[model samples]
Target: MPEALAILQKYWQHDTFRSLQKEIIDSVLSGHDTFALMPTGGGKSICFQVPALMNEGICLVVSPLVALMKDQVANLQNRGIKGIALTGGIKQDEIIDLLDNCQYGNYKFLYVSPERLQSDWILDRIKNLSINLITIDEAHCVSQWGHDFRPAYLKISELKKHFPKIPFLALTATATPRVKEDIITELGMHNPVQFEKSFARKNIAYMVFEVEDKLFKIEQILKKNPQPSIIYVRNRKSCLEISSQLQTLGFKATFYHGGLTSREKDKNMQLWMEEKAQVIVATNAFGMGIDKPNVKTVIHIQLPENIENYYQEAGRSGRNGEKAFAVLLTSPSDSIQAESQFINVLPDKAFLMSMYNKLCNYLQIAYGEGINEEFTFNLNHFCHKYGFPTLKTYNAIQFLDGQGIITFLKEFSEKITLQFLIPSKEVIRYTSLNPNDEEIILTILRTYPGIYEIQAAFNLPLIAKKSHHSEAEILAVLHKLNEKGIIDYHSKNNDAVLIFNEIREDERTINKVSKHLIRQNELKKEQLQSVLNYVAEKNTCKSKMILNYFGEKATTNCGICSYCITQAKPKKDFSTLSNKIMALLQNEDLSSREIQNKTKNTADDVIFVLQQLLEDNFLIIQNNNKYTLKT
Candidate 1:
């Protein structure tokens, strides 16, 4: 414990565990299966990270996020800990060698994405190593009701069957009461201890703006607060468009989406981290495992899918525990859009069957024979091929995944280099080499360090720089070396290809309805409530509402929200918003979009006034969608 504390103080600069971390750690120490529900920015990693070092054997962490798995492994390596992550980005043999280290050497941890759990070699070999703790990060994915669900998570429970005596831990940043219960029940945890921290960030002020021109509203928001920010959009195209627009406006902006190549993602992320890019317009894929402090604002140009997602995105702000802002720029059609999202979630059994049939039929699949089949699913191509609408088709696939009928993953290719260098004689003798002139031969061994010491990945650029060679030269060197029976490499930039195993029907039948659909619905309603709470708050305390949402009973208000800002005003006397129509018309006659943008009132009131204007002949609709003062 003392050593752990000292290490924490040196590395993370913290002295002790926060909230239930100690108890959770103790539970694992006692060999109990523990479930931790720490919110985003809360210390989920440390719970397992600390314990892994203290325990006798390595801890096997199963995570769903591929980038996060890589990140954690990288971070541990950075901190001088012996860790390895088995991602497709590395060659299969490297994974096998890493596993060998876990069994025989000082390797303390192995992080793997859940999808790898089903691999035949992984499953068979993992049991040979003495695993002290097994942790499932994002445990909520195991629940059928989570917004970010993955079919791969279902295999976690089977670990108990394999390692009956090993301690188990499940961790997630977001989960409702129902999902929490489902996690425990599904995983069959043994009298697990539950620890849930407050999800609220009191220093972050949540505000919503209804605007006609979203880009204009976003621009105004940037002008108003004007600090390092993240603009989250719903899709890749929007991420591209908004990022370009922000760049054009002279703001240093970058974008991230699933569409970007690994190299592009890494470069953009590095720029953002260095603060060279002040704004990152991204789809939801950008935030996990990112710990950027001093992010002054988080703007959602389109509403996020739920409050859990919103809270997570917003929590990225004020991480320094300083005051920051989380603004949601709303369009008039937002409500309808929310409903449309829900519409996709609530597909019936027929829709499920039809969608499944279409996919199978398109592939020329024959009923039960198509079971366990894998195919490269290109969403746009599939939709266009079958003349299906994009959103609905996407939703149908998600619904199928929720029911545990199919699996869908965006493509991931891997690039890897060894940090551990084998002796030149060993490399030559191990493969019984034939050629002395192989350039790739000497490049790889010197690039990595002590082979016997179990090194992980090294930076490719650093290797190239040290070797006095260009990147292409390094690549060619590694390629030849891999072919010359020296080392191996994994390339992930390749297209998405599916692999099927066992070609059998699904083991269990589902109701075609998952609790995820219901929970997602309730979550949307909860987000709407959050928006309502922000707008209708009369008390000066915005912090209290957020606390309440996180199940915290913070009785006192922080007195710094929009509510507090507006509370000092004498209540508006706009009894009917009944100012002289002349007061509103004081400006050059405004268009309906303009008039609506300027008011604090609802659409009904805005339209009611426009009607009165028409009654008094105070306004005129001229030249299509424009409105103006009467001539």
Candidate 2:
């Protein structure tokens, strides 16, 4: 073990293991099923990585996020470790070659998405490989009790049967006690070690602002703290608009959402990380794998779906163990809009079925006929063709996705649409001179007939099948032509790529939509509303409200919250210091330190009385800072 630690340090440059990382790794090394619940930044990867190196056979890691796995694999390779990942984007031959490498080469780790577990070839390959350990990242997806539940995860539990004796390590960041049990039962782990970490962060000061003018409140937050911050919005267009608005306000800001191209998203993120952009106006897509430790604030413009997401996102701040603020800017109008959006989200089964059927018709396929078919389902194009509200209809489709009807990550897949930019005679002349590639030239001509006069890029896979070459080989040939100025190809690979915005399902069939699923979504909206309510019903300690949401039994008021600081302390004798202060600023928000300076009292004494007044519901904080007597 000491030798193992020394090697880990020498290779990875980490001095020691984080909390429970050693225990989890040791359990797996001893061939025990391990269920690890490490908080974000608790170092979950090392738990599997160390044992994987010590194990006799390849460690197969089943994951959900393909881009994250790829990033990790790239980092591993940088550290001289051989790791491979299998996702939908990779060609079948490429995946086969990777599996072969695991079996024959010195590869010790293989990361694959849970969706790939559905493939017959993948299961067969796993049965053949000397796979000794299986690690499930984000294992909460397998449990219906979890917040981010996915039906594809159900397929992963079956892997236990394929390699009966292989040690299984299930890991997640945020799971309730119920979710924890569901993970254990779903994975059939016996007496697994439960390494639960506290969700509490003393360094983060949770503040909920009750504001009619959220923009004004945002301006105040920036003016007061003005450090590197993340502004989380709900939609893609909002990301752009908000970032633009912030830029207009003289703050260096950039937007990041799931909808952007991989290059654009990565560029924006790197800019933010490098401080080229001091503030990131992002949707929920900004924080994963973010190592910036000094993010001073995380401001939510609307609301998150649940506390788990809120906590994780907010936790991105104060990672450097410095004081940070997690603020929520909520309004009654925002709440109404959020609720309205939720209510309008349920898709009628018949409508969904009709849409799916239309999609199949457009793609020229029968029911269940296009099993592995992939297409660019442009919402604007589809909505234009069908005459439906693009946003609302698309959200309904997303709801269907949430119902386990389909796999939808809400991102785009960049694919090749090969169209020739020249005449057939010209192409033939070029191919004649380039006879070494006559096969691809002839293949393209045979597959995409009249490509020289085409408008749309021909489907590479469709062309590949017609050409009798693998997708990669076909792509390579196309790339050469593109490089030689004969054709053009586009690659749209992105981490936050949408798998299936809505799976091609029989939408017309009336099925029991999981109330559990809807409830999960509803919880997210409710979480947002809670922040709204906290801000609106001010004079309460904002940090205290946030802590309670994470199931903290403590009710001790966070006196430092905007609400507590603004509202004057209530009079104990019906004529105390709070009463006098309230009389002075009856309809205003008072800065606590400023008020303290005026009152000539200690911070604690002022906070205590203000908190008492807030508890007594004597006043409410509003807008940016001050408080008003409750009517």
Q: Candidate 2's residue-wise lDDT over 274-297, tens digit each? A: 998888988887776787888999
Clashes of 1: 5
Cα lDDT computed for each candidate against the true fold: 0.71, 0.72
What is the lDDT, from 0 to 100, of the residue 541 in candidate 2?
Answer: 67
TM-score of each: 0.74, 0.74
Deviation from truth (RMSD, Å), model 2: 9.0
Write candidate 1's Cα lDDT for 25-54 as tens digits. 878888888888888888789999887888
Instruction: Report the Cα lDDT for candidate 1.
Output: 0.71
Among these predictions, the greatest lDDT belongs to: 2
Which regions of candidate 2 are displaced past 4 Å? Answer: 1-4, 348-351, 396-552, 555-560, 563-631
